[model samples]
Target: MKSFLVGIVLGLFAFKCISSLYVKVLKPQSTKTGPERALLVAPGAYIKGEAYEPLGLQIRETCDFQLWVVLLLDFFDNIVNPLQLGEAVNKAIQSLKDEGFTDGSPVFLAGHSLGGTMVAMHGKNHYKDLSGVLLYAAYLTKGNKLSDYPVPVLTLSGDLDGLTRITRIMDTFQELYEDVSSNMKAKYRTPVLVMEGVNHGQFASGKMPSNVAEHDLPPDVTNVTAYQKIARYTCSFISNIASSSALSQQVLDEGFNTTFRLLEPLARVKALETNGFSHWTELAQKYIIELQNKTQISVRGIEENGQMIKFEFLFPKAEVHNSAVAITTYSLVTYPLDPFDVTLNPLSPIQIQAKMLSQERAKHVLPNGRYGAGNITCKDINQLSILEAFQNSSDVARERFSKRGRQIYLDEDQIVESSVQWQATQLRLSDGSDGLHVSSIKYKLPFDPIQESKSGLFYCALLSPFRAMEWIYVDSMRLKS
Candidate 1:
């Protein structure tokens, strides 16, 4: 009986030794194909390349794309030693390049969870070589810089993913979208797809995390169905990038409508929306207009109702003391007159002025766990008059305004055109104790504005508590006479 017990203990030890050796020395295999485009996939931590076999097969069957599953150092090492894992990814990519997957064809980097973060970090360095990046349930550090990466980025996250909240993912997306350079705007547009009712573990099809508490399971769709939809979008994104064409919004929207049942949470949307601007679409439109006006790029034409002439005036970027929680205001004011009168006399001069204001607030938690808040009004104000020009006008005018200390500078006086009552529409948001505010005045002139046709004005102001105040504005108005 003693000999038999000793033998059993020895057998268990031997099995453990062999398993450790297998995990430590295991290397990922390379799959070769003659396809023009190839997808290099990185697996999540503790998950082997075999776990992604089902996803890879789906990609092959549906899109006919080549797949390469990258392996890292063992699971234990990955959590502790990120550098070693990074080296493995680099070696795998280099091998793929040597094996006829040259830069001539598009190479896309894809990953799930930890794999997603690794590919993003790698793609930052190899952005020029890779066509695009796809991240699934990936981890994004707070204040992660997305502007440095120039290539197109596509992020997929589950709405109910507890590990990586959908709010954080969308916030990251907004940061990336805002940081896109003017030169790359035409070719690349970053789009995010949030799968409703899914969770973190479902991104991987075969093996799910044994600890269910860490995941947010979808009540409607099975894991298999979720993976199928993921594969479809992933393939479509890769195809679009390979063609060097802009991603098709129609295709993505259609897939989203068919696969996902819900939009982002209402509470998340409400947090970003200002009073009266209750819908996310309204905020999105405002940002879209601002981008178009700032970049001086207009892809769509304005509707002509044959009666009222309509155009947009864009203000400069505003500096917020609290970027995480701040209100954005966009106001449009138009002259009150007979629509026929302005149409008849197309050469009316417009005047523009800008002002800045500050406000403070205090809040405390009550004994009942409720909250109390109040605002402290400020008496400080600064104003400046901005110059304007019109198209077809030979004598173009330019003026510069500079402020020193608390002294405000006005290069020109306020020109009162016809006593024209203007209609004003504004979108504003206010939060916390301290905030900076700006107000602008604009008027139409007889001469055309000094910019390309269909261009608008953009103004930005910097009001910092620790530094001197700076006012900047960009006027790209080309008024038609």
Candidate 2:
């Protein structure tokens, strides 16, 4: 009887303990008995005498969703080599795996600044178990290598950070993307996003700076006012590639009737500006106008005629002497329409045929999330079926995610853009937070004219947190056109 009583009490105590882990620590499913689900790595950028313990605790708390540890690199005292930093992350991950903490839940490798750079260069390749990697304010000193990482990488940067040249880093990523595409000979690539308004220090919520506007935050925009907004978007992004439902309802609404018009060809894609926004709408308008004015193409004009909807495009008459019918048709399809309606069916036979041809062209080119193709080529212009371009990097970024696999977030568009023969590089707007404003700017066209002409499309993707802040203009002309 005494033994039975003791056993019952012990069992109850164990149950209580399990309840605490789930209810308090694990929260959602502490009752399930299995290996610990996830792990988190912290940034040890300035870990010195007074900073170590508190920052370590901060990181552990930040990553409470999964089992986590802080890697105390001597970066503060001795600027460690990136390779060494990579190895340290590997060791820590291995330790967790050794402790039998490996289950189906994800193992996250995350870091800040230099630490973020380390993960991008080494984490997924060295630590195979990492499910997802979140890099905050990190630059790729060396471009990302290892094509078969089996992990998703989420790279976040601030619009106005000077410490890490975000634009240069983005350019480097494009180079890496090109290198990877050439080596793998693969059609698709991973995704990278430059989150606007986020500075380098805000990845963890508690340590946000006071001066900055609550909404205009770096990653740490987790004050009371922004918590709900922050958590919803952050969690959804982190949980997994967003469900189609999670996408902006407005964007999705616009997409229902629209088909995809891939920007570049197989293995040869163009650099897409994932972070540009504010001026993209205007640029789209300008491109449409140019197509209508400059080329003998059937450019559409969308307007609502009260109850009746009107979608009109003027096509060059099929006079054999004027131009080849196919050329004229192709020109019309590539031309952008003003205030285009995705739902409206093509009106004229020429428009219908152009739309069909555009759809067929899209089947061959790859898709990178952007609102409209900028600086497009004859080959790329000829190929697209859909006329629309993605508005946000996330649109393209999510496409590269892997399901039930190691790699979670990736977009290889940058890499493919590099291999093209006619590559163009332009100085872009810098976010204001960096304190260094671009009061003046300059870039000579034919950015990389010689090598870029071969592959058909030649363009550069300008990655800046403040890319959407202003109109991108050269001395006289707008850059997007």
Candidate 3:
């Protein structure tokens, strides 16, 4: 027992020494001449900054942002001299300036995990001098305001990150996502992206033995693919931030166009990968509750008891605030399904029950359809067609909204809402890791479903703020007698 105890202590001491030594041995990157823009990258606790080389390399391929990898020795430095990390900010800026980067030149700060926290904390004092912030798998601590959000902030996180879960990232910036659309002036004010099938440590290229603490790891997506997507989103955000209004649109168009070109080949591979109908269907059912976009939207089970429709949606995970499943039920005769034409009108618009539910309350959803997790105020609304819900949607959004998403048969004039009373209870996410388990979601109790039109119904997609890269749609659902 004495020997075992000595061995454990010796092992810990050796690890502590070895970690510090690793940071010292890393060589600093040589400066590039006449760099267009500057980006200073920092690493998490106990992580070497060089681990982000692959991501930086990918980012530089598209954007002109010069990468200045900070040699932040967190494991030892954080323990012995934490203030050194903070002091390095001014030094890093001066270093950039010395390397021919001017005061007017676009300069950005980026950090991952704990390093991100430190960079965010720096915002309370020096955010006015910076152009923007790139936080990966991390969120700003409460009470830290970054230039009243004038600094274009992009928080890119992984959906499967266990150390810092995606839900926490959403909750941390719930205020930003929930704010009225008009008030959101700076397009890049807050765009929180959750990459599918990515884990916490995956953000950094080098995999170290230290990553064992990360939980709920991804079952799919290689690190290379994840980094490629990450770099693409990062590049787009940086380029847009640096561009003028007209130029920004061009940048977005190019980025989206690039994604469109890859979809054809990705679709072919996806088809081959998911060969069996049974396998695809099983994945589809699970995705509906998970907020993925699918080809069809099928309710796991739907019951029509009087005016109230109760659904057996599985469940949601634990988060800083709450979780919800957004269901788009479409009543349709349906046209040919096209992958490239998603933004186009799928068919006819579906009408919602006269009363109120999630969609009707919040007329225009955020870009990613995020109306932050909470009770959608249910009010007594007159018979409203799905088209009316998007009354405030932008011209671009309207093009899609006009004929997109919604599908439910039965005429809007045929709803027969006379003497109708409205009642709405927000759909809730139950507690714990039991998200895979089933739960009841009751949101409306007033408008009756057109009984005769039930069979022709084709639900569109189940979107959750916790969305994956792939979309999941329910092809169809059965009517309960």
- Could you give candidate 3's per-residue lDDT for residues 323-418 as a string of tens digits? 233332311111224343111121111112111123222222212333334322211111121122234222422343233322322211111122
lDDT of 2 by residue, 108-185 (tens): 665666556666656655556566666655643443442454565544444333344333334434544565557532
Give the poorly placed runs of model 2, Cα more than 4 Å off: 1-35, 47-80, 94-106, 124-129, 139-150, 158-197, 204-481
Query: Would you give me the overall lDDT of model 2?
Result: 0.32
Residue 263 in model 2: shift from native, Å? 16
Per-residue lDDT of model 1, residues 129-149, tens digit only: 678888877734444455555
Candidate 1: regions farther than 4 A off: 1-35, 64-81, 94-104, 145-147, 176-188, 210-213, 245-249, 253-269, 272-481
Best TM-score goes to which candidate? 3
> What TM-score does prediction 2 earn?
0.36
Q: What is the alpha-carbon lDDT for the whole of candidate 1?
A: 0.41
lDDT of 3 at 256: 36
Ten contiguous residues with the weakest lDDT in model 1: 357-366
What overall lDDT, based on C-alpha atoms, would model 3 receive against the true structure? Answer: 0.42
TM-score for each predicted model, relative to the true structure: 0.44, 0.36, 0.45
Residue 369 lDDT in candidate 2 = 15
Error in Å for residue 34 of model 3: 8.6
